[model samples]
Target: MATMEYNVFVGSETGLLKAANCAEEKWNNLNTLEDVKKDNEICCMCWGSSQQEKVYFAQRNQLIKVYNILSGEICEEIELNAGEGKFKNIAVFDQQILTALDSGIVNLWNNKGESELEIKTGDKLSCMRQNFFKRNLVATGGKENPLKLWDINKPTEPIFTSKNVPHDWLNLRVPIHVMSIGFIPKSEKIVTGTGYHQVRVYDPSTYQRRPVLNVTFDEYPITALTVCPNGNQVIVGNTQGNMTKIDLRKGNVACRYKGFAGGIKDLQCHPTLPYVASCSLDRFLRIHHMDLKHIMHKFYMKSRLNCLLLSKKWPTIDDEGGSPTDVSKEKIDDMSDALWDKLPVLGSKEQLPSGKMQKTKKRKLATKELPKQKMKKSVC
Candidate 1:
């Protein structure tokens, strides 16, 4: 039996929890009813903290709720309302959180829930990200054709901006809807994910919109984009459940691995390993090793998975059972017996915790394994 390498962060309309080590990962159910009712909806977006103590989650109600994962309690909830509409995304910095709202305003707040500053974007901010090197600077893209860079210190408007740079070789041939803007790890070069499954890597210094790669898929929207930890591979997952790793240096596909049954809603890459996690409306959390090119584990959830995150520091649950591959027929049968054998341990029917619920002999569990293996291969 090996220790589970991944711990899934599950968030549904009702609540959220960290589902841990099991053949089928089970929810620990950390969110209480009161918390869900207060926020209206469970987090619309959730990000795993680089900091060990916190898990960042946001609700549709325009509230950014930060949780202390170790204690399973809310640490801070910031009501983010700039002027109008709702916030679509939130990114955390060293000591502040940057929230991109529907009104094209990015609000900055500290851990104590106080507004530190606000960056006003002239266009609806569909997507945004902090610079990889400079924390004060941020990049945004959306309804506007140009990708704008803002400085928090200025606090009034963008310090520098670039617009409609021709997408000659980079092939940026679509609307900016749901596009993503990110800077190359340590370089001044920046990259954007066009809604049309094309990735444009831009050299900010030269304002060149070079098509790094044009990733084609069926009709599925590009749901999520992440850069590899090594900063050489660009991993993009589309709504069609296709995860492709492209080598930035060679501008070629490294390999493709598919696991999510439905369109991917979110994609997260590990900080230290070649592993990534993706969630979809299919209600399953899937783990894949980018290097191994195989499905590592699959865990079912109660509702549509809106977000998926991976961090080297998030806590995990320990189990005695073997890893997903090592499970044997005999072990499963033994588990089935143990599930029933524990019933007699109850002194009497009246001694049951529910008491009124009558006790009946537990039936033997089913022996069918899921057909997900075939499904995983089809998309790959």
Candidate 2:
């Protein structure tokens, strides 16, 4: 394979856009979003075009920036009319840009086509995710908001909306505060995190409007949620700097991980590798191995990171020095082999079938016979 390739892009709280290509060798492609004052605090970014060279990003200043990844040039800029409230989510579908505002409004714009679609989500929004299997479908929710899915082609009504959980022991109606949302790949099922620090999975196909499975974490609002590529588990991070990998099938935490000194702003897992990258108020980008729970790469980007996007491609065995910075299976095997090579060889021992000890033969000392005469010689 001629160095498999995938693109990675991240936008930070300080309004910087970083881009790079992951390949067989260490990635040297990086960009700092410092020069453009308007690009500060990138809220969302994605491949706006079919080509790998172009991308679109939403900013905190109500401006959307389009850039050419290969040339490091701003190709176009579209301004959002939505007043106040930061952008919480953005996605590209059918050559149109869809942005969800914290104030609960979603706008779909086609700058080149000069067509726009807007919808009022009622309550303010915090996050939005598109169902890859259903390109025309999307899920959106936020603080005190219920998770809702809409068919973008219509934009007037939601196809599904989550029903609140039943009353507690006191029979008080439970309030909902959706903080983040994720859609299961290839299924109508969706998962959401809430301000109450709960993770719930909902299947719209079922008659029950309530979550099929609901689990709680630490008492902090969930800030980030990412479904594993396998679509069997979801990685959740909350406002308290807590992270956990929840097994959907088991309906419980599969593993607990540590390392975020500050609350996690965002998390993204490698599509094909057992690695996850996260950036947060700690001002550092950390890549972790899901299985080993090892921090593979730690890069101080010198800013509070709010979001991350990882490449889907991973290095393979045949590539030359495949991804020196990435901790893939090939790299781990090589490291294990090298580690075993450095271990000390043990001293050889005789093989024994039974639990018996070998007795040493007693030899008569040649000087023993003279021992009895030692006193006589000394006296002479």
Cα-based lDDT for every prediction: 0.65, 0.76
Candidate 1 lDDT over residue span 1-380, tens digit each = 44333356655655554454434455455566565553455544545444555667777677777767566577777776556765566777766787877678788877667777777776666677777478777887776546777877786767556555455577865455546665677677666666667666666566344443444533555667788777777777776788788777877778888665677766777776556787777888787767766776677776776765565653332367443333334455787899998776666666666533432423211112235656688879
RMSD after Cα superposition, model 2? 9.3
**Which pairs clash in model 2?**
15-40, 15-41, 24-323, 144-177
Each model's backbone clash number: 2, 4
TM-score of 1: 0.71
Q: Return the TM-score for each candidate structure.
A: 0.71, 0.79
- Model 1 scores what on Cα lDDT? 0.65
Candidate 2 residue spans exceeding 4 A from truth: 1-7, 20-39, 112-115, 313-380
lDDT of 2 by residue, 192-244 (tens): 98888889999999998999999988788899888888899999988778788
- Give the top-scoring candidate (lDDT): 2
lDDT of 1 at 303: 71
Candidate 2 local Cα displacement, residue 106, angstroms: 0.9
